[model samples]
Target chain A: MNADAVPLLEARGMTMRFGGVTAVNNVDFVLGEVELRCLIGPNGAGKSTFFKMLTGQLTPTAGTVRFRGEDITGAYPHQVARRGVGIKTQVPNVFDGLTVRENVFVAAARLHQARTARRIADETIEHVGLTRIAGRMVGQLAHGQRQWVEIAAVLAQEPDLLLLDEPAAGMNKEEVARTSELIREINKTKALIVVEHDMQFIRMIAKTVTVFNQGSILIEDDVHTVLSNQSVRDVYLGRQAA
Target chain B: MAGAIASGWASFAAMLLAGLVLMFGLPHVFDLFGLLQMTVFVAMAVLALSQGFIWGYGGIMSFGQSAFFGLGGYTYAVAVMNLGDSTGAVALAIALPAAFAALLGYFMFYGRISDAYVGVVTLTVTVILFNVFNSTAGDWYTIGNAPLGGFNGMPSVPPLNIPGHPDEPLDPGQLWYAAMGSLILVYVLLRGVLASRFGRVVVAIRENETRAMLLGYDPRLYKLLTFTLGGGIAGLAGCLFTNWGSFISPTAFSLAQSAQIIIFVLVGGLGTLLGPILGAVAIQYMVTLIGAQQKVDGNLIVGVVLIGFVLLVPQGVVPVVRNVLQRLFVRTPRGGTAPVASEARP
Candidate 1:
């Protein structure tokens, strides 16, 4: 990545305190355009908290988040979304009562005219390989398919940046492989930050990895470098192995 | 997709046709008293639709819907007496309650009140209104010439009249036409709204508020707007209700009335356009029949039926009927490909 080129997202001195506990401490993070990055951490490692701040789900106690050079710190989720940021939380967020296509249409209709919403929904549904069950209610879908529907809904927003939390958390190997392919295909046009505990899943999609621990970044480097780092293994991978 | 849309419109058209037949044909067969009773049921159906939209479609679960209903009746009674006319009174009856609901909803939703608290606040408002109106028994409580009758209730409220001729009130038969016509119009209008882009956003918010927010739609605005619309519809029903009985009472704001309105929605089926209307009309009709016997307590009978419905037909009549109909009509061919198998879990 070019140092002089303005990154797609830049966070400076990000901090979040919940009561007396500091959930996320001061941290600086940056992402380049169309970058594929994975964030890994333990349960309370603050990766989720940091992601929430980045996506405007939570207003940080202190920090500045800029996207394409515009300060968006403390903006609401909808406001951040309007600025071309799509977020998929750890839980599946698609409307269960609505059909698979309708879920995507709801997301797309916000940014497109009603006449074009159907077309956009169709394209996104197809992209996620859910075309066959597009007419089925999302609630009736299996867990993995429900997750895919959520991803399709997010993709329908056509955001320049996508934030996905635990996208492949409950998937089998084949489904996880398919998710990796989908993320890579999406990365051709948009930048992505995927938070996952599955190391194999991350290894397949991550070009660069950022490891979070104890509310702060433990390491930021190439996937191989981060995986091989002694400190990262001792603090994170070692615990996982145990 | 085209087939689904077409079928939806077809069902709507069929419902309108049935309504037209009942509106025109009922007066021919029924006596004046029967016609009046039917008209009252029609008005109640509109009330149920209002609650259905708010609770069923919007996921609001308001328990104080009768507050708006009673307000509409009281506003109409007071307006008709003071203005010596029904035209402006009718408009005020609908608009006042809607405006009130907007104010209340803004505070409830924008102020970030929880859903459970919203139900409590609304029910309390209704109880308060009931007490306030019940106490307005003195002569000084009069709004112009319309005396607030206190516990005795106001009788002989001015019936809806032609725009220019207040003296020539609509007869019971004519009022029935107006009542039935309004029901049909409200149903069609609501259907149109629920099918619109705004309606989709409202339903999405109802399903998942956080997801809708992430989709760039403000859930608060959509919920507030839906609540206001529901209030306006309930107000219209109340206006019609007052006309049907030629009276208004503080009982309109009673907790029993509010509970009955919720029962109407629940018995009809949530989120079904026709279900609430059917639920209200059927339950009211049953109550009327049992009340005439004077042997069984009407409230007791209604309570029993409601309990039975809740325990047995939990999804309500309309959805159950729809499921049966779908099974009969849309049978898949034997050995046809099953719905694409969902991915196996780890």
Candidate 2:
């Protein structure tokens, strides 16, 4: 399916301004097929805004976003999703009144395919190890489990690129370790752009890391290089970069 | 499960038997006035189901169910009046209201306004229709002609046309049977839909709209379908109502009428399909009993009871009852009882 074609997604000089404040500024980001990219930034560094723009939740003030050689600059969120990009939010967003299977089936129905939707849903749920709670209502799930469920939902989309916003945010150490493993496994088949604050988890899964500060790219390098860079260290230590 | 079904059917049969006895024996045992009062209560029960569909299950709070009811009533009145003493006009009576409801639902749902906006839009539509029917002129008007039956209502409207008996108009007995049949049909059909896959999706939307959107299901489209389907059912009740009275008036579409339906839904339980009917019957009976008390104001009594019910039960009678029963009788599934808060995505 054109797996080795040009980068699956490209954001060229994308900038997003909220009134007087620039949330994201002319950031050039690209994701090749099966690329696992980590997006990192300090608090208020516009990482979330960048993620939103990638998924078409927010329109860029300037610059163009291309998906598979097609310029899709201002597409709607659902339109982008239908084009094979999946997103899982940090917080749980699911039908609280429905059982887990029902939730999966509802999402799968949008494909208008066949019973394969159910099979896909089941496989993803199994992959996430949520079989025990498959019949339970989403409303009553724990923080970590909810995160996993959201991940499973995104996976059911069979996306080319999956955008996850903080999958390890509220998890305990064990849950975080499990999630790190899951992300690495998923990255083998699909390109993933994960926005995360957990440096350890990011270092574990990301081969390439991009750091942002004040809406622009601060450094884009391999995990080890970025971790040891003086500028990356200074930014984390809350000091001016030397 | 079998036992529960049997008992439920038994209870339903008992209620039906009692209603039948009263329907036939009321004129002899009590008076003509008593029989008529009961009919109004049943009609209002049907209207309550309309409210239940929009606000309870679809999570849309609509304050315009009465407008549809009024439309249904007027449609039946117009059709029956034109057809004269024909018994076959019953089909037209039902079809006209259902058709109007479909139109109203189409505009409201397709317009992408089904939340608070739906209530406002429906209310405005109701008011406009009321005025239009009231202020309509010659040729411009078809049935609701001037005097336009202003305040007094369009009286002397023809009875419904019953097929095979075109020479004879339907009597009150025939109308009562038709209403009962319709009430039963609506109850079963709505219950079936509630148990279907489409119904499951509607419930999901009510639970988490944003999640539904992300899942690629448009909440607005589902809401529109719910609204239109609901309108069609309510419009059926409205048609029955016109035949019951042989009259149509602006009071049928009043804001107070809408409120009464809301009260029924709230008192019954929002999401449960049968809750509306139970709430309607219970409240209607309570009002009737209270009205019989010489010193009591029926409206005040109904208002107070409704307020008390909403405050105390919150989830309505059926859900509260189910909760209590679960506490008393049900046991958790032995092995498959997952953690109550298990949020695993898959």
Candidate 3:
């Protein structure tokens, strides 16, 4: 058996519904250790719903989520987090009134001792290229900076599988490139499940892509293969089929 | 090291200086009766601090600190009347309220009660206690050789004696020193707690529970512990309140008491310990002044002040004043983000 023989994460028969609307329909997904996988989909395509299920934000209408070999179905977000699963939500969920260093410090403090957390906070802030503005209040930072601060906080968690939702949601071209580089550097050691909408940004970092459509995964393959598929263009790229 | 001494440490040092000045200086400035009255003000300031700690820092919308205060007063009165000693009674006072708070907090936090509902529910619980205590007037409602005199209250409640020595009751001057000492101790204790890792995490939960939960901290447990501590502090103040007049009454749990605690925090400033102390003493002094003159009703004036503060200075006095002073004194580059101390050291 290989060192990465067991999947790092596994979700089986994941489903979600709101009233009569089936937001996500029985989707199964898996990822290996030390791998980065991108999830791409159009708006309302249920990728967000699936991501929420994976992160324990939503208790699926029907499904089981497992980390390594443990059953973590319908676990609370905090419980999932303690099991070495960390997530960066679409919005920058941070302590807005606190300094950037403090925000990272709190996250780092969760899994480490005081001195260690402090060292990690400073390191993470530097890692995310926010060292210059580390003392500034997070609310006072620009949108892109807040996102990076959130990413730094997530990194401080030292999670086995880091799931990021729309990490480049509002970034400019320069910021997007920087984020992709950050993601690549991070992916060298950790596994990642990134839900993204930006295909151009995806090309910079994604080796394997999982394109989702109509509440299920349309295709899971190498990024180049998925990008060239004709049906993927029609469904996700919104191009007219020949 | 100077950078490590952030706003939190600066405020703590200022409070220590202020406490020392008040401890030595106030007795000389006031008559015997004035010293006794000042003791009452000190006790009430402690009450205000309790509410301030919970509602401001805990982010718990508790409108029932008066319930804990009243319970403390009544518990101290009953236990002291029976045992003829205040030591066990005083301990009971703090423990009872903390226990009650843990029970209430368990239900509220565990039940996942909404914040708005928490405020409403706590207010309703206080009102219920007021009614229940108001009706326990008959001789039949006695507890272990102590009377629960209902609305009339157990009058002439025994004053607190030196711990374990029932005969050695504190005289007016000594009581004033004791009460003032307690206030200062609580202030310092809370400041020390805030500077600790646990306190920082509590503030983090107050900032954003969802974020805190995501970071592997249980917000409910934190909220419960904070609410319990607030209850215990209010109870301690209640014991002092009972000793002030040598009386304990249902009126301690009155709606007026509930509102006044909020008013104190609102007037002085929320999220700061000194603000409540200042707010309580100043407001109580103003009320006494208004009481001395029959020209205007004190309640009406206080009510008007509450409305005025809410509309005019929503951030309250201390914060607004601190911000103004910071701007005037601290020189930062114009239009640049104001530099803040990076992280507070414990």
Candidate 4:
């Protein structure tokens, strides 16, 4: 990706204040088209808060978030999604009572007509390796499978940018490996920002990583550089160790 | 999905046929009074359907549905007296309540009122309307020639007339057909709406609002539309009620009447289209029978039945019956195993 090309997503001086505490402070980030970036940090390090602001889940108290070169500050989640930005929150958000296929179908239906949505849902389900369990209720699925279902639902939207929060959090090792592969495959066509604490999983998928600490970006570098940075280790890896 | 929709349409057709048979064929066995009583049940079923669509499917538990019902009745009564025409009055009856609902719903939904507060606000609105209507007994409390009638309630409400001729009011037999026809029409229409893309989105919102929003749907807009549609249906039911009893009353806005509507949806199967109708007709018939016997208070029996249904079959009659039927008959294609039973959860 050319550095001179217009980035797919750009956040400038973004800050979020909850009363007296500043959850995210003055974060500037950029992702190029077809880029795969991993955001890693300790709990309450403000990575999640920054992701929320980027995805329109939370409006920054100060600063701007631009998508495709247009300001989308304080946009509602629905509005953001409609702009071809797919978001999967930290928790798996799938309709429990609805079938896996129906879950994807509803998401696809948001962008396409009903007839087209059906085809998209099936194709997305198959892409997510959930074809066999398409007819099964989402609630009955295992935790990892439910997470994939949520991913499939987001893919059904055919978004240009995918923002996934802790997509591999509860997954077993095999599931995590599969998820890393899935994210890499998707990154071929769409830009992605995966927020995860698992270094191994991030190493498998991310070429570049952004480290967040104290509500601000502490470092942005290649995976090797970020892993070797002493400050990154002290604030994030040190906290994880404790 | 197509198969599910086809089965839904098939059930709708079956219900329509059954309704026609009961409406036209039953008169031969029952007397005029019996037919008249059946008309009232049909009207009540319409009211229950409105509640079912809003509360059961839309996941909006409203306790002010009676406000719309009473609004419809009063609109029809006042309009009929002024225009001397039932056709235009009927239109106004449905439109007035729908418009009011749209305005009220816009504020409540857009204001982001919480679910619990929604119930309280709606219930309070019904109570306020009931008290207001109850106090309008003065000579000045009149719309056109129709007096408010205060606690005594408005009497001699003009019956629905033949479309063009105001002098020719519908006879009892015609009124029965009109009520039954309206019920069938509303049922078919509601079923079709529920099968549409919009209906799927609405149901998805009911299931998981945040997920629906993340899918690019504005939940507030869908909620407002559903609330307004439900209000219109309730208004239609109120029009039918006025025609059946030839009266309008502040009792239409009473909390008891609103609670009874909720019971009808609960006993029938909340999300199922036909469940609420069945619940309403069955309960109304039982009430009429018990009232005729004069041994126990009809309301007391209804209260007991409501409690029994809530405790024994919380999912409602239709869903429980459907589950049993599915378990007994439905089998998976891969194996001869019985299909999993999934209850509707909002």
lDDT of 2 by residue, A90-205 (tens): 57777676667667766776774536776877777888998888867777788888888788877886678888989999999999899999998998889999988888798789
- Native-referenced TM-scores of chain A, all candidate models: 0.98, 0.93, 0.96, 0.97
Task: Name model 2 segments beyond 4 Å from true.
Answer: A1-4, A112-119, A237-242, B1-39, B83-114, B136-140, B144-148, B163-165, B334-346
Question: Candidate 4 on A1-242: residue-level lDDT in tens?
Answer: 68787788989999999999999989899989988999998899897788778767788999998898999999998899899898888888888877787789899998789899999998998898988888777888898999999999999988999989999988999999999999999988999999998988988988999998889899999999999899998998876777
lDDT of 2 by residue, B33-115 (tens): 65566566667767787778767777877778877788777666666566554343445545555566567667776576646
Query: How well does candidate 3 reproduce the true complex, by DockQ?
Result: 0.49
TM-score of candidate 1's A chain against the true A chain: 0.98
* DockQ of every candidate: 0.51, 0.34, 0.49, 0.55
Clashes of each: 0, 14, 0, 0
In the predicted model 4, the residue pairs found to clash are none
Q: Model 3: per-residue lDDT, tens digit, A1-242?
A: 16557688889999999999998998888888888999998888898788788877899999899899799888888898999888888887888877788788889989788689889998998889988887777877899999998899889989888989999989999999999999999998999989898888899999999988889889999999999998899887854323
Error of 2 at B232 (Å): 1.3
